[model samples]
Target: MDIRVKFLGGAKSVTGSKYLITVNDFHVLIDCGLFQGLKQLRLRNWDDLPVNPEKIDCIVLTHAHIDHSGYIPLLYKNGFGGKVHCTEPTLELADILLTDSAKLQEEEAEFANRKGYSKHNPAKPLYTVRDAIEALNILEAHPFDLTFRIHNQIEVRFFHAGHILGAASIELIIYSSQGIKRMVFSGDLGPMHNPLHFAPVKPPNADVLFMESTYGARRHKDVDLEKELRQLILESDKKGGCILIPAFSVGRTQLVLYYIWKIFQNMKSRPVYIDSPMAISVTHLYKSFSNYHRLESDSEFGHHIFDAPFVHYVTEQSKSKVLNTIKDRAIIISASGMATGGRVLHHLFHRLPREQDIVLFTGFLPEGTRGRDIANGEKLVKIFGEEVMINAKIHVLDGFSAHADQDELVEWSGHISEPPKMTFLIHGEKEQAEVLRERLIGRGWNVTIPDYLETFTLFDHV
Candidate 1:
C-alpha cells in the first residue's frame, strides 16, 4: 500500500482549495474550490485538472466558502459522480453559495455579451445553475465529531473550525498495511475571540497536517471592535454619506449586522440596508442554527439577534438599484467581500466616486482584486467596463476578519500534544505562508510550503 498527496490548488494561493489524496487505486479530494482573485488564478478554473474528475472516488469538504467548495459543480459537470460530504450546516450553506455563484456567473456572462466588452465572442459562464443543482443532489451531511467511512481503508471525522456556520477541520484516518496513519486539514481557522462563532476546536494528534496561513504574517489590529465601528459610523454620519461595506455573505455580513444592531441601540441610527439576497438568506440560517454560533438566543431587539427594526432586506434587483439614489446617511452591506464580483460591484460603481461615502472592507482582500486596488489607494478602478474614480474614504477593519491571525494560529497549533512528522502551510499568499513556515520551524516542527501542483509521498510500501 502507498499514500500520496497532490496540491491541485490552495497551495501557495489564498483561494481555490483542492487537494487530492491517493491511497493505492482509490482517490479522495479534500476540497474542490474555484480559483478566484487575479486573472492568472481565475484562468486556472478553466484549465483541466491534472487528475481526471471521474478518477476521484469521493470528496470531503471542510466548509462551504466559495474558495473551498465552489468547484464541485464544474467537477460534477465534467464527469465526477460521487458523494460530497460535509457537516449539515456546511451542506446547506454550500447549496446556497454554489447556486448564487452560478447565477452571478450567468448574469455576468450575459451582461458582458450584451455590452460586447468581453474578449470571448459570446461570454459564457463556467457552469450553469442546472449544473450546481445537479451537483448539490450528491451532498451528504454528517455531524461534527462523528467518524464516517468513505472507503474500506479510509475513515473521516470533523471538528468545529469556528469560521462560519458549518466550517470544520477534517481528520482522515487511513488504515494501511504499515499501520493507521492520521492526517489533519485545518480549514480556514477563525479568531479565538470571535463573538459570532466559538473558538476553533483543536485537532487530535496527526502524522501529517495541512494548515492555513491566511494571516500568518500579520496580527489583526488590537482595537475595540465596537468602539471603532461606532466611531466609523459617527464619522461617516458627520460627512452625511452612506457607509458601503463589502462583506462576505456568510460570516462577515452577519457579524457586521450584529455589531451595528448592538451599537444602534443608544445612538441615532442610519437605515441599515442588506442589499444581497444571498446575505439575507444566510442571515436566516444563522437564526436556524443556534448550536453553531455564539450569538445569544434573544437580543435587546427581540428573539433573533438579526431582527432589528432598522434593518431592511432588499431582495429585488430594482430595489438594489434604488439604493444608488440615496447619497447620505444610510448603511448598505453587499456581498463578494473582496469586491471580486457580485452586486457589490454595482454598488461600488456608484459609491466609489462620491467623496462623502465610506467604503469599509470587513475582511482580507486578496492580491489582484478590485478591493485590494481600491484599499491600496489606487485612484481609479475599472468597474463595469469603465474606470471609476475612487474618492470615497476607504477603511479596512481587519478586526472583523474571521480568519485567525498570526498569534492565534500559533496558539491553535500549540494544542497538538505531539508534533506531526510533516506540516504543509497552505491557503495563503507566498509571503504569509513563508512567515508561518519559519515560525513553525523555530518550534522544531518539520514544515514545508508546497507550491502549486506539488505532490508528496506520505507513505510507501506500507
Candidate 2:
C-alpha cells in the first residue's frame, strides 16, 4: 500500500491536528494537536485512539501552540514512547505551554468538582501536570530544515512558518524501495509583514501537503498596530477604567507586550498589570527565547524595561484577586485568550463594566466565547452564568493575530521545490479553511480539506 495519512486533528473545525504517515514498516505522526473549542472539542482529547500510540515511531511538532502540542501529555499518559521532535524554540515553548495547560486543566476540574458544577463526581483533568512533564521528557531538539531520520525510512526537517515565536512548516521525506516522496505540513503561518518575527518559510517541495486555514478566507484591516492599541488604551483609561486583554499567552501576549512597550514610549499614565498566573510563568520562558524583543528592549534599547516600578505581575491568587480592589485604572493582561476559560473569565465577571474597563483581543475569537461576543459588539457578556455589561471599550488588533493571511501563505509556498500530490487544510474553521483551499485550488494546487479522522493513502509519484 502507499503511505497512509489520517486526519486525527485540525480539520473542518480547526483544533487538534494529528496525521499519521506510514511507509513500509516505519510510521510517524506529523502533529498531535488538541481539539479545543466547546465540550466536544475538549472531549476529543480524552477519546480512545483510532491507532495504537505505541505503534507510532515518532512525532513532529509544527510549533508550540497548545492545540498543536497540548495533547502530547495525554499521549504520554497513554504510554507512547517515541521521541517528540521539534525546533529548539518549539521545544522550549512546548515545555512551558504543555505543563501550564495540564495545570490549568487539572485546576479547572478540581474547581468544578468543588463547586459541584461538573457532571462527573471526579471531573478529572484530561491529563495531569505530571503527564505533561513526562511528555516533555521525551522531546528531542533539532535545528530547522536539517533533515534527520526518525526511522530507517523516514527523513524529516522543519522550516520557520512564522505564525508565532517558534512556529514552523514541516516537511517529510519518505524513502521507499520504489522511490523517495515528500510531504509538507504547514503549521500556523505567521503574517507576511508581521512585526514580531520573520515571515513564514515555505516548503522545499513535497508530493503531499497540509496547510493551515486559520485566516485563509479573510483579509486583515490595514492599520498600525501600535496606534490602534494606543487608542484603545487611551480611551479605556479616559474613564479611569482598567484594560483587560484576553491574549494567547504564547504569541499574542508577547506581541501585545512588545506593542505595549511601544505604547509606553510616547505616552505615560496609569500602570499595567499582568494577572495571568500562567502568563507570569510564561514571561520567563519568553525572556529565555527572546521572542518578545521589546521585553528585551532593555538590552535592545540598552536599559531595563521591567525594571520600571509600575509594571506589576500578579502571581499569587491573592494578588490576582486584589486587582479587583485596586482603585487605580490599569491594564490587566489575562489568559484563556478566547475567554472560553481561565483567569480572564474572572476578570470579565468581576471587572467588566460600562466604559470604565475594556477588552482588547489579539487572536481569533472562536464561536460561543466571551471574546467572540466582545469582538462581535455584544453589549453584554455572560460570564460564569452572569451577564456583565461590556461598558468598557472593546477592540481587536487583528493585525497582531499570529497566523499569516492568504497572500502570506502563497508567498511562503514559493520556497517549496515541487508541488505535492495533495495539500490538506486543517486547524481552521470551515470558512477560514475554505478560503485558503479556494485560493490554492485557483493556482491548480491539489489540495484537500480532510474531516476529523478521515484517512488517505500517499501514493508514490512516478
Best by lDDT: 1
Least accurate 10 contiguous residues by lDDT in model 2: 294-303
| 1-462: candidate 2 lDDT, tens digit per residue | 367887887878767878777775567887787877766877877789798888888898888888788788888778788999998888988888888888888988888887777788988998888888878999988887688988777788888787766677887887777777777888888777765577776467777778788877877778788887788877766667778888887767656676777678788846778777666666666567664232344464322444345678877888787787754468888898988777778877776674577777887877656678778988887666467887766777777777777777776765665666788888888888787787788877887888888988778342
Error of 1 at 194 (Å): 0.6
TM-score of each predicted structure versus truth: 0.98, 0.93
Give the number of the best model, judged by TM-score. 1
Itemize residue pairs with steric clashes in candidate 1.
none
Model 1 error, position 19 (Å): 0.5
Model 1 RMSD, rounded to 1 decimal: 1.1
Models, CA RMSD each: 1.1, 2.4
Off by over 4 Å in 1: 299-303
Candidate 2 off by > 4 Å: 290-309, 379-382, 385-389, 460-462
lDDT of 1 by residue, 355-442 (tens): 9999999889999899999999999999989999999999988889899999989989988889999999999999999998899999
